[model samples]
Structure formats: structure tokens, C-alpha cells
Target: MRSEKEMMDLVLSLAEQDERIRIVTLEGSRANINIPKKNDLEFMEEVLIDDNMVFDIDNLKGFLNDTSSFGFIAKENNKIIGFAYCYTLLRPDGKTMFYLHSIGMLPNYQDKGYGSKLLSFIKEYSKEIGCSEMFLITDKGNPRACHVYEKLGGKNDYKDEIVYVYDYEKGDK
Candidate 1:
């Protein structure tokens, strides 16, 4: 298995080199605060070696399930600092669009152009695939992501409750 840093470096480098991986999206409760705990086996083991047994199976399952929905990750120096999850929606107009469910960079890695680089790659990928447009939904409360989407040329189409939909043509960038 690749070390965490190796995996992260690979992800970022692949994004840099490839053009068909349009619009990385992230989804599921991994972004949710009430989602439950994540298993930190390495940390836990290191901290509590004397314990007979302490595991939260249900929490582990939930965390695993949440992470499974994300199809890709962006890493820096072998650590996962960002990720995107995607889902495709076929419009009634016969146009197929890809929706970016979520994307985030680690706090320390924010504002380093990694997000834009990943998104540019995604947009190019969408164009190659014959997709006319790409869409994203973000919580209005999360202004940072919203700002990124707008800077990337996403237009707001609808807003209700906790989510806002932003869209852009494949080559709008």
C-alpha cells in the first residue's frame, strides 16, 4: 500500500497532468458535523495500547460509507488535504450534466490554487466528454466555497433551505 503522502502526491500530480477529470465533487455526511466519529486507528493505537478493546463499529461503518461516496482525493505530500465527489444527472432536455457534490481543501492548504487547478481539470474533462455544463450545490453558509464557485464563473440558479445551486457551461472558464 502507498503511504498517505505518496497517495496524496499522486492525486495532485494526476490532477495536474490529466484533463478529463472535470469537476471534482464531494458528498455525504463526511462534511456533516453530526455524522459521528471517524476511526483513527493509528492515533488511537498509539495513544491507548493498554486498553483491552475499544471500538465503535457503527461509527466506523458510517464513516466508511460516507467516504466511499467520494470518488477522488487531492493530496499534498502524501496526505489527503482535499477531495471531490461527483454524481451525474440527466436533464429532461437530453443534456447530461455532472454535479460536483462537494470539494474542500485542508485549512492549511487553502488559497494555494489547488482547488482551482482541480476545477480547471474537471471543466476540461467535461468538455471532452461532450457535457454541456457542470453544476454544484453548496451551503450558503459556507461562503468560502461559494466564493470559489463564483470566481470560477458559476452562476446561481436556485436557493432554498441550506443549499444553493450554481452552474457553468463546460468551457465558461
Candidate 2:
């Protein structure tokens, strides 16, 4: 298992690479003014890195300049344990969708309900903002997250698409 710091570094690096991911915020104790209010940054603690690293706050800000990004944090007792990053996009059908880029909790927090709660919040918020669909892609090796998503009513149309989609369109089926 990767250490907490290593896992967090991977998460941050992925977010930086994905242009769709616009916001990066930590949840636990401190308030990060960077993440927008649309996505609740309330739970997990923020990512803390050693000062020796070259990357700094200014670099992060420069990367996450788009205003359309949003994220969530899962925390317990003022300590961050997990986080999620997402972004919105307009589909070819002229409807909007929320794409869950990444969601993960620390090893100690796994099997707990934190992941479910965070996803639930994101689902509800997506509905509130008129998203016609919300979806995510998780590795097939990670059955735990897949189970959670299935339990929350996401469809298993992952055969060829490799995506779990939650369609909210009305009366089109």
C-alpha cells in the first residue's frame, strides 16, 4: 500500500493533468479559498506536502485557473482523510454533465461510509445544477468503489464504455 503522502501526490498530479478538473481543495480544518462553493469542500483534510518540494501554492493556483471546477473533501475530527475532484461539461445533446474525475479515501478510512456520503453529495448537487447525466470511470481492479457506486444506483454499462453512468433524463427511455 502506498503511504498517505504518496497517494495524495498521485491524486494531485492526476488533477493537474486533467484539464477538466478545475478545482483542488482540502476539507478538514482549514478553509481553502481556491475551491468554488458549488462543490462542498467539507469533509476530508487537505493535502499537506513537505516544503522541500518545488511545487507551491502559486503553481497550483496557476494550474487551477478555470472557475468551473469543483471538488469535495472528507474529514474526521479536523483531519483530512479523503477528497474528490470533478468538472462539468456540455454534451453533444445540449445537456450538461458532471464528470467525477477521481475519488479516494485514505487506507484507514476505507470501508467506512465517507466515500458514500461524499458521492451522495456530489450526485445531489449535480441534480440541483441541471445535470442530465453524471458519471465516472474506475479501474476494474477496484471492486470496492464499484460496489459503492452500484449500491448508489449507478448503472453497469461498463462493458465496452468502461464508465458507470447515472442518467437523470426524464421519460426518454
Candidate 3:
């Protein structure tokens, strides 16, 4: 588990890498309210890093910068424990679809409903914003993630589906 300080640092570092992500906000406290609204900076917290919180930061700026981007955060005792990053895809019919790119919580916070809360928060928010559907892709090996997703009424359409990741830098594909 990463210390609260480490987690915040990781998030901040990712935000700073690209000018597109100007303001990063943490939301979803116990009251189910959103704090530090988009472009709101006063509510951001600073912490000193002493441990590692791992996640892929690649293309995060593009995701965060998208006009359709929106997500929820989980905090406890005034510290960030989890975050869900996502964006919406629009169709000619005008019904947008929400794609949950990623979501995770600290080790100590897992299996404690914090993840569920974040998922539930975003799921409802997506609907309220006119999203026609919400979906995400994950490795089947991650049973924990799959379980939580299913517990929240998520369906698996392609159980044997395989995912391929292509990392191209600068202009390579």
C-alpha cells in the first residue's frame, strides 16, 4: 500500500507532464458530493512521496484533456485513496457512450467498497449526463476487478476476448 503522500505525488506528476491537464481535482467524499470541481484548484492537496503507487500514465493527458472527460475520486481522512478516469464517445444519433478507461484503489482500501463507490458514482453520473451506455475492458486474470464490476451489475459479453496493447512513441505505431 502506498502512503497517502505517495499516491498524491503520483497523480500530480502525471498531471504536470502535459499542459492539457491544468487542474486535477479529488472528489467523492463520504457525503457523495463532488469537490474541487473541474478547473478548480484550491481543493488540491500536496503530499511528500515515500513509496510507489504504480499505474500507466501514458496518454493520460489526452484522456484528461478531452472535452468529454469526467471521473470520480475516493478520499478518506482527507487523503486520496482511489480515482476513476474516463471519457465519452459521441454518436451521430447524439447518444454518448461512456468508456471507463481505468480505476484502482490502494491495497489497504481494496475489498472495502471504496472501489464500488467510485464505480457507482461514475456510473450514475454518466447516465445523468446523457450517456447511452457505460463500459470498460479489463484482463480476465484480474478476478478481483471483474468481481467488483460484476457485483455492480456489469455484464461480460466476450469472456474469452483478448486485448492487445500497442505502445508507439512520437510518431511510431
* Most accurate candidate by lDDT: 3
Q: Which runs in model 1 stand beyond 4 Å of their true positions?
A: 1-70, 77-79, 159-173
Candidate 1, residues 37-137, lDDT tens digits: the string is 12222322222223322444433234234422223444444344565556556789998787776665666778877677566656655566667788876
Give one digit per residue, the lDDT tens place, for model 3 in 1-173. 76645544555565555332322223444335433332222223311121222333334344455677765555665656766667789889988999998777767788888888778877877898788999999887899899999999999988677887775853558
RMSD of each: 13.8, 11.5, 7.6
After superposition, the stretches of candidate 3 with alpha carbons farther than 4 Å from their true spots are 1-31, 37-65, 170-172
**What 10-residue stretch in candidate 3 is worst by lDDT?**
42-51
Return the TM-score for candidate 2, rounded to 2 decimals.
0.61
What lDDT does the true structure give each of the candidates? Answer: 0.50, 0.62, 0.63
Among the numbered candidates, top TM-score falls to 3
Ranking by TM-score: 3, 2, 1
lDDT score of residue 135 within candidate 1: 80
TM-score of 3: 0.65
- The positional error of residue 168 in candidate 2, measured at the CA in angstroms, is 34
TM-score per prediction, in order, is: 0.50, 0.61, 0.65
Residue pairs whose backbone atoms clash in candidate 3: none
